[model samples]
Target: MIDVGLLLTMIVAVGVPSLVARWWPLTTFGEPVGFLDVAIWPAMVGLGVGRLVAVALDGPSSLGSLSDLLIIRSGVEFWPGVAAAMLAAAWSAHRSGVASFDRLADLVPLALIGYAGYEATCLVRDGCYGPETSLGIRPPGTSTTMLPVGILAAIAVVVGAVVLHRQLGRRASWAVVMGGLTVVAGVRSLAAIWLPHIGDGLTRQHWSSIAVLLATVPALTAGVLGGHPATRERQLLDR
Candidate 1:
């Protein structure tokens, strides 16, 4: 069973993003805007809040639990923070006259980088452990394989974005990057679903997978509509 505090944290993480989308009228990457646009800040804040909560609940040992591997999944706690971040980001983009979706597309790489960084920090601070196996490779003092994977993913996202940006132009490249992210995220979810019991700790990959799929619907939608002159014309009139 998941710890009550951890459960609460997960719930908040999932809920925040949905609430932001419902509350704010914005779109991300040509998709109907939801919590992702505003997710950055709230996620950051949540990290802090989560840490404090952990300290209060378990003292310094909480840091060791950071490396405990879990599937990236969404829950009530995570989404709300994501939604808040998305809301803020969308509003800022709208006010600046940048296409909210387009802006978000460009920022996706950076966002991933930040997220990975956070995960790495958590691994160090919490000292979580992964499964023990003959094939397992542990970093200096940690017990999980997540650190390397996290770093690799982060590098891939950032490098891909940079290369795509240079070759395809910002808007097109961002769309491609985000589209790829959506696909990778989806595949990861599927793997989690199939394996179900592979990761060491409580896996949230299930929630993350669902959220990514949901988010992709809007992203693809926006990409399609954005290219239509009629949509642009309608948007101009609405503005």
Candidate 2:
């Protein structure tokens, strides 16, 4: 049987962005970005990529049938999903002939909120546990007391999103995209500290998170130091 609770949560997670993006008033290169493209395409594409990646990582034995692969209850790779979603968003913007960076800035918070909501569902589902820890509370039905990595990561992402929205949402800048992603990748890195390594003393998530942090931090710094060209242009146009 399908998990009704998780299914509903997923729907809400995706739905909120789709509804809100319709009226959020975002633009790229002085043109409005398509709401459905921003809010829906990335998420759907990401889910598919994440699911496939997870199954591949787990090996063919994990894939019982086409139906099994289709059902997300099995597992999904979080990092791959995020990367694919971002690519999908960029592609959507590109297809619409927009520069994408400014549009991405406005969309970042909504994406983070939706991501956090989806991760929150990890609390009730299997396959999201952290390494066995005697220090923290144990999830129900599990004998080993795990670190509750999923919920903690979800909380961290939500907090990051709120902070980003409050601090930078008023102005459209590349910082929103870079900063939001930095926070998320940092959270993933932290979570990886408690997760068991698949190989080489680091989980794939850890490597991915580190890579993102490295790429985004410098870009975020430069954007802040130089000021967003779009924001500056907007200021000049207003004057």
Q: Taking the tens digit of each residue's C-alpha lDDT, what string does model 1 give over 72-161?
A: 232123334444555565576788688765666554544544443443332343332334445534655654453234334434544543
Number of backbone-clashing residue pairs for each candidate, in the order shown: 50, 0
lDDT of 2: 0.74
- Who wins the TM-score comparison? 2
Model 2 spans > 4 angstroms off:
15-38, 60-65, 127-137, 143-147, 167-172, 195-200, 228-239
lDDT of 2 by residue, 1-239 (tens): 77876777777677765665565545453666554555677878888999989898886776667887887866778778887887877886788686566657767867777777667776565545788777865766667877778788888987887776664534445677888889888888888787655566876667888998999999877766766566778899999
lDDT of each: 0.48, 0.74
Model 1 residue 180 CA deviation in Å:
7.2
lDDT of 1 at 85: 52
Model 1 Cα shift for residue 109 (angstroms): 2.2
In candidate 2 the C-alpha lDDT for residue 75 amounts to 75
